[model samples]
Target: MGSNYHINNVNGPAIFGDNGRMEINNGTDAATLLRLADQLVERMRVESPALVPQAQVIQGELAQDGRPADRGRIRAALETIGIGVAAGSGGLALAQEIGRVLGL
Candidate 1:
């Protein structure tokens, strides 16, 4: 089943086959996809505004002292999400985990 598919409590005759499979083609579900994308964007928008300045400051300080936190992991993760790939259930889980961590 595709990530966006919603199965409800509707008992109906079989449509596809005895065992069915669902595919999300070309991400045509614009409204739902946009909603999910917006959620991700919002998270970044909130987290990023503060982080970018801090990152730059820390990076500069570390360069001056010859010690830097390797931020490649964070940069790669951001790039991965920027290229239209849905983060899937893992993203949702991470978001929930963040909420729990912050006591939201």
Candidate 2:
């Protein structure tokens, strides 16, 4: 198996399997994903407050359940997060990985 990489892309989490292919949910059923992520954000408040607004932007991009997600907006949101965090943050790394997959 390859390394596990987590991305909250609008399409949902994507995993790279042993075959070097990305396996993702067909579309998105993540209606409440951002809501759940917000719960985690609460814990992060004392540590990384700057991420709160970035998280909000990401939450805004989440798709309604049973709908096709906006992959482009999701990517853009990642870029926005990249701007708000340190270079070494997971958000930047995730965005880079996603860009590689997207041929950007």
Best by TM-score: 2
lDDT of each: 0.37, 0.52
lDDT of 1 by residue, 20-51 (tens): 63222322333443344345445544554433
Model 2 misplaced stretches (Cα beyond 4 Å): 1-48, 90-104
Clashing pairs in 1: none
Whole-model alpha-carbon lDDT for candidate 2: 0.52
Candidate 2 has what TM-score?
Answer: 0.40
Candidate 2 lDDT over residue span 5-78, tens digit each: 55565343246533565655444335445544454345335435776665555455553457744666666755
- After superposing candidate 1 on the true structure, give the runs of residues whose Cα lies further than 4 Å from its correct spot: 1-28, 49-79, 82-104
Give the TM-scores of the predictions, in the order they appear: 0.25, 0.40
RMSD of 2: 9.7
